[model samples]
Target: MSVRTATESDLEAWVALRLLLWPDTSPDTHRAEAAAVLAAPEATAFLEKAEDGSMRAFAEAALRHDHVNGCETSPVAFLEGIFVRAEDRGRGHGARLLAAVRDWARGRGCAELASDAHLSNVGSRAFHAALGFDETEHVVFFRMPL
Candidate 1:
């Protein structure tokens, strides 16, 4: 399998893969946001492909100026999300995708990579642990109407 950074030309395919993996987003929204993100100098997307040229996994990361736990720099490299097609999950595509993101962050001088998963997502928690991430503080979130 090969791993590479995503480009604007890959927007449609990336959005489709993201929807297939997550299933909670509208394709239109995914495309719009992905285009904007791909245009950002401090954000990046990566794709893992099988030798047959099928996309097996993808990951995105961005620089955050705010303080993030476990990060020692202002521009913390935050992993937005990553997914490997269920059929490809056990074959290391996810790990390759993550490695691409980490390499991108390191190239940009990021201090650390950070990620968050839903509190009830056991699979996500286990994956993070397997990747050597420690459990940090958890908090209840609230939003106020203007």
Candidate 2:
């Protein structure tokens, strides 16, 4: 499996995989968001393709100049999303995609990479830990509508 940076041509496939990861969001929204990320200089996405050229996994990241929850520096790389097809898990595709993201961040002068998973997502937590991420803190958000 070869991992590479995603380009405009990969939009449709990227949105498809994004839906699998965030099914609650609409496809139109995913398309718009994917397009924006593709056009943003501070953000990037990496994709892994199979021998047949089908997309097997994808990861999106961005350089966050603001404070990142657990990081101690400005301009940290934030992993916005990563998804591997259920059948493709455990094949190291995710790791390879992350490696690419790491390189991209380092190229942009980012010192650290930060990411978050939902509190109840045990598998996601384990995935982060397995990849050498240390748990920093847990946070709960509150919202009030006017």
Candidate 3:
């Protein structure tokens, strides 16, 4: 598999992978958000493709100027999302994508990388841990309708 920066030509495949990662979001919203990310200077995405040129996975990340949990730096490289197709798991594509993200972050002068997963996602937690991420904190958010 090969990993490369996502471009306008990769938008459709990128949105498809994003929908698989975030199923609750609508396709139109995914398209709009993907476009915005593509256009944003502080954000980027990478695509992993098979030998046949089929897209197998995608990862999105951004530079967060605001405080990111567990990070002491101002401009943290925040991993927004990453997804490898079910059949494509365990082949190191995800890791390769992350390696690319880390390089990009380092190039941007980011001192730290941060990511979050839903509290109930055991698999995601394991993935993060296996990738050398330390458990910084767990937070439960509450809100009220005013």
Off by over 4 Å in 1: 144-146
Candidate 3 residue pairs that clash: none
Screening candidate 1 with a backbone cut-off below 3 angstroms (N, C-alpha, C), the clashing residue pairs are none
What's the TM-score of every candidate structure? 0.92, 0.97, 0.98
Candidate 2 stretches with Cα past 4 Å from truth are: none
In model 1, what is the error at residue 115, expressed in angstroms? 0.4
Lowest lDDT sum, 10 consecutive residues, model 3, at 46-55
Tens digits of per-residue lDDT for model 2 on 18-45?
Answer: 9999999999999999999999999999
Estimate, for each residue in 111-145, the C-alpha lDDT of model 3 and write its tens digit: 89999999899999998998989989999999999
- Could you give candidate 1's per-residue lDDT for residues 1-146 as a string of tens digits? 78899988777778888898678989998998889788898998998877787777889899999888766777888989888888888787878888888888899888688999999999998998898778777868899999
Clashes of 2: 0
Q: Residue 31 lDDT in model 1?
A: 92
